[model samples]
Target: MMLFAVEWQPPRLDTGDLARIAARLRGLRPLESILDDIGDVIGDQDPPAAEAPVLAERLRGDLVRLEDVAVAADDRDPRVAHLVARARALRRREAPTAAHPVTVAHLRRLVGAAEALLERLTETGTLRACA
Candidate 1:
């Protein structure tokens, strides 16, 4: 049997509803990358007709969670806020192509956005236990 590696979903956005919009300025860890990776993988899947939309919607919900956390935390740092904006744009772009044109470059861009957010959070200590 081919074994699939189990991945853990970080708890940055779910740390706390209130903490979702907070501050961090020390170099710790990056959580955005995790979110992005999750989205990229989900968006790139070729599930059966019954499962494709469900997977897409789940991925969208995850992105929305990050967006909500970022918006809540934007008051803490503008970089995080900007990351949120980029993620939102990517989400919108992915929605149209969820089951059609899932390109490698597109995946890279999505992951890149997440990486950028992680770097900012790590440098700023916004993602500690969350990462």
Candidate 2:
């Protein structure tokens, strides 16, 4: 009988990769804040004219940051791509009016999508602090 010894090494992440992951984790805070603002606007009977555009712009910027991190990490998560696409679509729309229920619904979905993406990233160890 022959005995064989096998060596196992843990996966390695470079400093740049860790920095990107940390940045992504930090970016989640602003995304959550934007989602909260969107929810507040949705709760209102009449959302202010200027507020929606500002929120939408903020959301777009946050999504762009997330997308850049995802791309740098070579993340293949479908939800991340979908979330980016949705944010881009929302960004392209004219300022949403209180009368447009569909737009409100889309905003709600976008918030949900952002939350989902954040959860997935956290779960995948991609949002962990650099150690």
Candidate 3:
């Protein structure tokens, strides 16, 4: 029997790739506010059961888009990877019936990760506009 192991190599992001990532990050920023508004609505009153699921689905879509950018950027940061995994898990667990509390928490974490990644890009000089 032969055992083979494949090593994961991070892709080198070129100038154009970095620019695209910056644009994606900018796009994701609006989702944070959307999530906050949904959270507030959930907290303020008893809304229809369908409301949360709709918001959760939207958040899931945003997270998936962010995840695509992170993977493209070849982000190796442990925190970013963890958040991506959480987002994936949340997406997998999404149910049409109701929104789970865990989903909300994951969305918050994913948003934070997006912010952190943007900051990381700036710190590494990958995103000059952000700096």
Candidate 4:
């Protein structure tokens, strides 16, 4: 009888996704800073009338950046769709137009949503240790 050899191969994990996720996580710092800025604006009891427009423009710029990142991530992985939707919703929100008390509450919600999304993103990892 002739002996035959069989080879076993390990399953492959998506390392590219991990690398992209890592990059995206690093990209979150600027968004976090903008969120802090929003919080500060919300806390200001007597923000000058002129300040509202500047704050709105700044927040809009950062939220647009966030939307771009979220959309790209969602395109890569549909699992990120929910978080992406939240980013879109916040971008379209009227709260940032002015920092009224209602806007303050909305800004707080926005911050919470962003933190949750980041926390969820951090939970993503490759199935294999080497992956």
- Largest lDDT belongs to which candidate? 2
lDDT of each: 0.57, 0.61, 0.58, 0.57
Number of backbone collisions per candidate, in order?
5, 0, 0, 0
Candidate 4 per-residue lDDT over residues 15-62, each given as its tens digit: 997799899888665445654655656565634555555655566555
**Distance from true position, residue 73, model 1, in Å?**
3.4
Model 2 has an lDDT value of 0.61
**Residue 35 in model 2: shift from native, Å?**
5.5
Of the pair 2 and 4, which is ahead by TM-score? 2
Model 4 misplaced regions, further than 4 Å: 1-32, 38-57, 74-79, 96-99, 125-131
* Model 3 misplacement above 4 A: 1-47, 96-131
Poorly placed runs, candidate 2 (over 4 Å): 1-49, 97-103, 128-131
Q: Candidate 2 — worst ten consecutive residues by lDDT sum?
A: 122-131
List RMSD in Å for every model shown. Answer: 16.3, 8.6, 9.9, 10.5
Of models 3 and 4, which has the larger lDDT?
A: 3
Q: After superposition, how far is residue 1 of candidate 1 from its true place, in Å?
A: 70
Off by over 4 Å in 1: 1-62, 95-102, 129-131
As a TM-score, model 2 comes out at 0.52
> Which candidate model has the greater lDDT, 2 or 3?
2
Q: Against the true structure, what is each candidate's TM-score?
A: 0.45, 0.52, 0.46, 0.46
